[model samples]
Target: EHIKNYSKHIDEFRSQANSQGIWLFISTLGCWSVNIPLIQVIAAILLFCIFIFNSKQDMTEKRAFHKIEEDIAKDIDSNLIGDSRKARLYDLGLVEKYRKAIKPVLKTSPIFIVCYIFYSISFLVFFSNLFPRMKLIFNF
Candidate 1:
């Protein structure tokens, strides 16, 4: 049951992250189209900061979940006795299997940030060329 709940939470986080990414892309595009270098730079920096904050938050939650799982496993190992211990060991094995299955989902990828950086650079180049007045801003 705990594993199920954790899985559900992970799914929710994934959905929220996807939604935020979509909104970030949309807002970035909107700012770019406005052709104001200052606004675009500000929006990009703000959005990147938000992304970093969310990733850190997600990582903290993941650590908390793992701590809970470890505590449960420890309790099963040290607290039970005899027949109940045997039964709980079976359950522990199942828990281990579930943990292995979800391990990949819990990892935070760096590729997303790399892509964001690439996109930002490409736009900076494009903007500098398109708006000569903004060259000072970009160069700075």
Candidate 2:
């Protein structure tokens, strides 16, 4: 019964974590598109909203994971070596789930890095063109 409950809790936490990661990945990309003149204020606002929601989500998942750990610890305190082993296995499963949860973030990390570099270069180009003095410092 405890193991089944543990599995359910972990599954829920995993799903939420992965969903949050997806939102983070989206926001990272959407950052480059933010501009008042470009009429993407709505996207900016939505991204911020998602960020806030994800923050709450992160908290919830953390609490759930912590609760599971505490429950397992209590089981171990009862001197049940079998349950202790099961708890350790469950912990390993959670670690695996976490790795899967971050897949979207890992997959998009390189893309985000590239986009950030390009965005920075483009912004510098625009800035140097608009303010000729800045170009002297950049040595461009």
Candidate 3:
């Protein structure tokens, strides 16, 4: 039961990370299309910061979930070895169910990384054009 709940929580974080990635891509394109260099620079920086934050959170949650699953498996193994009744309670079917619930969380798609790289390149191009204007405006 607790494992299922934790799985749901992790799933939510994954979903949110994907949603934030999409939003970041859209905002980055919008930033690129806008004529105002200052706004583009500011929005690009902010969106990049958001992307970094979301990525960190997603990684942290996944690591934590993995740790929890490992600990649970260890505990189950120890208990099964120590007691016959507990071993029966922690049967293969129950373990399989837990494994099935967590299987999706373990699988990751690389599309997010591809999208991130694409946006990062776009931002670099956007900034490359804006830097000279910034230099001219600031007399740098």
Candidate 4:
């Protein structure tokens, strides 16, 4: 069902968003050491950019799901079930609750976005060879 797909998309995007934060932080930390190599730094910068792009894609997907849910909710509420006042009211209330719950995402997402940008810039400046060196040091 469409609702099921909406839930799935939101869940998947949420995880992607979390990873954006984690990887950005890791990339920033990697740049802190002095002995990290150039290739490793380049790789980390590339990886961070990739993660940021993926996060943006995920956010777009999430917005699509949210819009779909809103449209479906509107369609259901606008037609059919002529006499089920209580049920319709309950559904409307639930929809409003869901909308409110997701509203904080608008605020929170920007903070994460800004943090990621700063992290990427810092990683490029201070840790260009950091990621490759990490692989050897961690024996990965």
Which candidate has the top score in lDDT? 3
Model 4 per-residue lDDT tens digits across residues 74-131 = 7666764666645655655554455457564555455456657777566544433345
The TM-score values for the models, in the order shown, are 0.47, 0.39, 0.48, 0.42
Which scores greater on lDDT, model 1 or model 4? 1
Candidate 2 lDDT at 7 equals 61
Residues 1-140 of candidate 2 have per-residue lDDT tens digits of 56556566555544555555465565646655555523444554465577567656565345545566566657755656676677766674665465456664455354444444554455455456547876833545
Q: Which segments of candidate 3 are over 4 A away from where they belong?
A: 50-111, 130-140
lDDT of 3 at 134: 54
Off by over 4 Å in 2: 35-67, 79-140
- Local distance difference test scores for all models: 0.61, 0.56, 0.62, 0.58
Model 3: how far residue 87 lies from native, Å: 9.0
Model 4 lDDT at residue 25: 70
**lDDT for position 12 in model 2:** 55
The residue pairs that clash in candidate 1, if any, are: none
